[model samples]
Target: MKNGKSPGSDNIPVEIVKVGRHRVIELLRIAFNKCLEEQTIPEIWNCAIVILLHKKEGTGEKAGSDHVRKTNEWLRHQSKVTDVIKRVARLKWEWVGHMARKTDTWSKRLLEWRPWGEKRPRGRPQMRWDDDIRQIAGTRWLQVAQSRDEWRSLKEAYTQVVETG
Candidate 1:
């Protein structure tokens, strides 16, 4: 085949027509390795890492969230990096500390920010953290917060729970 897809399709995502698969896998392997090597779990995973590789972007790749979910699920069962997983978990604690620092700064800024506004928005801004999210804010997490204070509080409370448990 001249390309991975049949020649008949008129519209093709450019990434599919251009980049090679082995290269893409190699990059993920690199990220995985770097994450392990640094003893850090990246705060961000580049959208381009997998988003650009979507079949919608490339004919050869899968586009649905299920595809990504299945991939991660497979990775979970694989025994290739059990030790690395533990190290990553330990790194998560450090990330919690970083999050606390960021949130404390945010809380301070928001306190100052209030002076700039005549009145805060009524009802809710949709970013407020409640009790349950705070409960899992640490070692075992469920959801994430957009603002730093909510994240810090959640992590702190969650950390207590993990320590007690």
Candidate 2:
């Protein structure tokens, strides 16, 4: 539910959902539960809007005799799409660093704090938000994040590690 993303087929913006807040969350939860019980999602969920940009010159006019051929050619000529997973990982890593450096924000506190008396009901420990940060920057990642230059240097390696593993 990140902001500024394009609306889906429903054309409902994220801002509208944010305005609804808890009421929206509760409604969504109920709807999702009902969908799970019925084993069917809304038909609107299957719809998508795919807009093909006219990347080359002398294109984008109304369809004509050569439209299909030109569209196929343009599609074939396009390079591979950028890796979304790597981009998201890099962004998350950067955000973690930013939150880590903030002195007294609740975000920073929650990022570092573990519950005092929480009991685990699992064999293996669950993965955490900062697990990748710890993997790249070691146990002192928070301290390292305090230095912007040092944190920035780790971004490439972090993305690579995330991409591969």
- Per residue, candidate 2 scores C-alpha lDDT tens digits across 1-165 of 679998876788998989987677667666765665565889876787877765554454665433434443353234222345676788888898889999888988898788889898869998976787799999999999999999999999999999888
Reference-based TM-score, model 2: 0.53
Structure candidate 2, residue pairs in collision: none
TM-scores of all candidate predictions against the true structure: 0.26, 0.53
Worst 10 residues of 2 by lDDT: 73-82
lDDT of 2 at 122: 69
Tens digit of lDDT per residue, candidate 1, span 16-124?
A: 6456655655666677777778757765543223324343333434563343334643664552333454444344544544554564476535422425547777887
Off by over 4 Å in 2: 1-80
